[model samples]
Target: MDALDIVMNKDKAVPYYQPIISADKQEIEGYRVSGKVKGEGEKWIDLHPFFADNSIPDDYRQEIDDHIKQVAVSKYLHENRSELLFFSLNPNLVVPENIEQFIDRLSVFKSQGLPFEKMVIELKEHQFEGDVSNLKHFVQYIQSLQVKVALDDVGTSSTQLDEIALLQPDIIKVDLHAIGNSPFPSVLTEVLHSLSSLSRKIGASLLFQNIQEFTHLNYAWRHGARYYQGSYLSKESLTFLDKKSFTQALNKDFHRFLSFEKKKIKSQIALTDTLTKRLKNYLNNNKDFSDIDQVTKEIASVLSDYSFRVYICNEEGIQQSGNALKDEKGVWQYRVEERYRNWSWRPYFLENIVRLQYEQKGMLSDLYTDIHREERIRTYSYPLNDQLYVFADIPYSYLYEKDFLL
Candidate 1:
């Protein structure tokens, strides 16, 4: 028998273990049983490529996902129902047709001695691309069984974001590859921010995986991620059957204390260096805010991630001139200085932006908005060092529909 036959025949191929630890408890809560493609470690990443080459039909998903429900969770629970557990299963979007089969089996396990509450069915990230309707029904049905669901590999793809919102999972497991390396990429940071917001909206927990060292754990901790599993953490088999090791792992590993201040100092200086380099490049080209209108127009495009608007302000909260946004219309008009020149638009000046730019010079103003734009738009302002350069982008609203400050 080749790989396919071996995969079907081998009990180990259908079930794998992931360690689950609590942020507050700081101990092994339980292990979730997940399905794995049979291969070397790196082969895990390229399993889909293998499937394609082997001419393995889409129908393989039914057998694979079914093997998960039958052999993985059922067998584990049969032997060790006394201990808590968490099982991460391949989502197998291809076999959504067998969703009812999956759910019924889980419900059967729930009815039996297995602790359904501890079973966490992880929908593997982006592997299966079958009917989403089957996937949705599967998730809802599992939740109905009191078996919690976790979106595994959350940082892997934004494609799952909407499904995450719609499904409202009990946990979101972050990928190991994302936060493991040095100089955590800005892209990952932005993605995590979006993931955190979505998690909050759904009242789901965040689980970060693959923390190679203390720094990775600290980063996740600061972001309010409560559940964790990683190497920096002491490893334990999260299995219920392995009573001796599991018992030992269940106890807290006291050494991992987080010093937020230290992390802050290190990260802040690094971030400052990054920002300074970026701002210096901006300063390098413009020399001064002479082309202030060009600067404001560019601000919207440059900081498209953050809604931007240009504002002019005097020492007090008095508004000198204000342009709150670069409209979608992209109209070319007066100076960033001109927005506030008409004192009647004085209402544009708000209490927030004043504190941000005041006393401190050449720093990013905290995000805010001009009250005059009916507070529909969010804004930020940077100080033009020269008083004559009275113009600067006030703030730009990111989404056109959400904020009218545009």
Candidate 2:
């Protein structure tokens, strides 16, 4: 017998539930439905690998998918009518040719008083093949039934982004690979920021998956994630938890995170204030300075431990001096030929310059990746005079040391 036939004949597929929580960690927003097949000696096989295996016929795969959904709806969802149901499907099995029949089945659930609005159909990201326009039409038709759509296990690929735009899913599930454990986590932070911006533009929410630690949860909360799921919250099981106890535990964790964050924000403000005061003093003392080298030397001496590079720019955003960089040997080096680059196109360069020119006050930018060094850094810009602005770039390590980037 075929693998699909064996599994079907044995009736081994069983549904498991994993809770997805709200951003405030106050309530259970939904439950993701997964499946597992029991083995001879109590070993369980995940249904993802079974559906992923190419040897399984499309018909059999569709049947299994439909069966899981039908069972979950008929049993668990029917009982708990308040919370949402996140039902996923392999895109390969739900092609344009068979999508109409799938829609008919979903409509049947709607007729039973469980509307499609409460059901989020998650589409496995990589299985998005076949006709693109036809898939777009299928998404539109299902949405017309008031069913919300989601892109599951989304990665940071351009193709995946294009698919997201075309499908216009209501939620984007960030894969665990994109948010893995790392001491620095700068790239993961950047990817999350990019995804957050995209979701905001498309009017969709973000759901971070595989959040197995407090570090991951901290990152997600800071980046505006509204929905979350993983072993950190709860393991998949046949039974659900009492809503009151589930929310109470979640609230305790949430409050703990908030308490730490409040303390960190105060430290961030104090650090920024100290640097600003020192910068103002140095600029004031060097009012008559003409040589760029002497100015860089003085600035480096004052903020040596906090900054790595320093330069001067004019109101027109034209670089007036070469870059003074702190080298690996712990000494400062000047790059004389690195001048004349334009900064007018940067996000806050012109705005900050204008503010400094008018207010004669210094400004510090939010944490951002420096294109030249490809590292996270914050730039401090102070008005040296009406025409010149001194710019210093501080590496992210300093802020991280103060627990500001958590």
Strongest candidate by lDDT: 2
For residues 82-151, could you state the per-residue lDDT of candidate 1 as single tens digits?
A: 5445654556532565566656666676776676776777776465566666667777777877788888
TM-scores for every candidate against the unseen true structure: 0.58, 0.89
Per-residue CA lDDT of candidate 2, range 315-346, in tens?
99988888889998768998878789888888
**Overall local distance difference test of candidate 2:** 0.77
Whole-model alpha-carbon lDDT for candidate 1: 0.56
Worst lDDT window (10 residues) for model 1?
Answer: 397-406
Assess each prediction's global lDDT (C-alpha) against the native: 0.56, 0.77
